[model samples]
Target: MTDPAIPLGEIVLPCLNEARALPWVLSRIPDGWRAVVVDNGSTDGSAGIARDLGARVVHEPRRGFGAACHAGLLAAEAEIVAFCDCDASLDPGAAERIAAPVRQGSADLVLARRRPTGRGAWPLHARAGNLALARMVRRRTGLGLRDLGPLRAARRRALLELGLTDRRSGYPLQMVVRAADAGWRVEETEVPYRPRTGRSKVTGTWRGTWQTVHDMRKVLR
Candidate 1:
């Protein structure tokens, strides 16, 4: 029951030193879907790996996660765009799930809520932050988000209409808030979130955690 409005779109993966996991992530993408990999100044050969795997490479010198994602969105030709992390934390096939609501014209933005399955995978602090952010988003925007996860899909027109302008680590939450404020139809899918292949840039570092919280609060305000 694939939604018909789900036009052929591009998948954007933001990579920063993800050489080890890029191959697996790229390989898992379903055929016929174009991919754009934004290399956020990776010292590793992540951009090269993505290019070799048939992804259109976009160089984003900026270090922010949102910057890389925004670059990919601008580079993509597809009307519908999907953004996901390059750490292999999400299922590639789940793109279909995100696209379903859009295809049916029921939603313009589809966010994947991570339902962690494996033992001791997601860190406690990260989980707490995710839950707190979701609560704040629901309270502030009246948009119920199960999680502020990386895997999400949206139509280009809707994204632009929402003015999704977070060019930093808190981009996910910002986009959701803007979409809600703009009255875009939004949906959330419960997808499994696995442990990433490499060290997570945000969840694995204290500075990143603080920056994420601070930026998210700004977005909320």
Candidate 2:
């Protein structure tokens, strides 16, 4: 067990106009864990909210999901690094379970398989798109990952060595694909998924889901 006073790891949260959800998300971070909130040009004071809440805020001027994630990755200082959405759909507190395997040398990369906690928590189109993409990932990597969820953990140095290059929606999938190629012991566990606090920037509408699928397809190719 890690001492509550000692730092554990850093969790990167990519943000964009998520002020309302910031408080709830930040409060859930476990003791000794650092929160690096990557503000992706949020006009809703998300950056300030994060900073005031004791989360280190990294400003990524670029407006892509991958860009923001990469920025947070570069900013991370701990040996173990995790990533979660700032939308509050996923619990930041649950990162401990996801990260434990990596810290214990049991897994190289740990992903969260989301189990929706309520109706409308996950949109139908988004769910369908994710299923299709997961199938593609299985065929490409020979890995049986169920969900390409944002909540995940890995070693910071190894992740950097993957030399991830995607700066769009394909970033997450590219990480998994590259990890599999490198023979990393990628695994996953279930986490409850709740409805987000505000409008989703992606995977909330049919068009958004299609765009995400398209971006991920580029990685599969």
Candidate 3:
């Protein structure tokens, strides 16, 4: 049975050493909503902070973005599930935007576009690579997606039925690609993006970007 304290929809936060940012992220969840934070083997005590701040913490021993995200989905008992990163780059309240379309029956999936609020919000190399990759995805898959953002929402049943298998940085990419090919109604909304509290695990460095791109390319094939 779903917990009564958890409202109609739930938000999942995949965390990897994001202790400093949990307080800010957890504080912004809309009233009556629930947050599930999946700790992806963080030695930094991120799970403790998330628990203290009222989020249900699910420890995922595996240390990959997709693994944590999948664990969060498994823990979620709500009918609607939204995924968000706990890097403090995204506004936690933006859960409303992601959930609204699905709740209103207008769309099956929604992706949040990261509109950086200031300089340094996104890296130059990441930006260039993201543009090229987004174009490639649109041309090949025809999803009309602009960003492979962490802040996204969908009916839990629909998401799980896609049979997603990627468990790394390619996880989100696989979700987007599969959903598009499955004929899901996907949409995008703009959300304020700020600088993250700590160094990015992906999209902030050359090595991380390379791995992400490589993994995503593999998923596309």
Candidate 4:
């Protein structure tokens, strides 16, 4: 039930080799909201899947989460933008919950704090690292946010005004930090994190974790 007129918000799914999960992700978008998938150099036919399911597909061959997300943002024209991981880990059913605060004009930025429902949904070291980073973010920015979860929502214009430059794993952190610095009201909503359809891009291996940490350091510094 997509809106016939300009939509109030749009959900952006940053995808990479997620052909198997694209349908579920797009189906999770609530009625009346528009959906866009940023295909990140997927050789698995993810872009075609998105198109077949009635979602607008934007090609982003940069091969990074932030790069794909930034491309989606540029292509999105709604007043609000919500980002969801294309992998099945994060529930698409919670899109409305995550974007509610922003749509209601009560929050400038909202993060879907993950409540993992499966054992392997999150790795031990990754959880510890994320917690530590969350604390560091609290101390550094005074935003009081609890999670840097992949699922989040923001007012489109306000987000664009932040001038975020990170094109990797650090994009989320950069957005939150810069938004907080600019005095935007930031909030968190708990969303279930299930077992993902495929391996995580950032927490799947030692190399991935190190690269994420390195990129995050560049933003945090």
Strongest candidate by TM-score: 2
Compared with the true structure, all predictions reach lDDT values of 0.82, 0.93, 0.87, 0.84
Clashing pairs in 1: 5-103, 6-103
lDDT string, candidate 3, 149-191, tens digits: 7799998888899998888888988899989889889899889
Q: Tens digits of per-residue lDDT for model 2 on 83-169?
A: 999999999998888899998999999999999999899989999999999999999999998899789999999999999999999
Rank all candidate structures by their TM-score, best first, as comma-separated numbers. Answer: 2, 3, 4, 1
As a whole number from 0 to 100, the lDDT of residue 35 in candidate 3 is 93
What RMSD does each model have against the real structure? 3.2, 2.0, 1.6, 2.1
- Tell me the tens digit of each residue's lDDT in model 4 across 125-218: 6777788778878888987777897889887888888887888899988998898888889888898988889878787876677667777867
Off by over 4 Å in 2: 1-6
Off by over 4 Å in 3: 1-6
Model 1, residue 173: distance off in Å is 1.2
lDDT for 44 (candidate 3): 92
Candidate 4 deviant stretches above 4 angstroms: 1-3
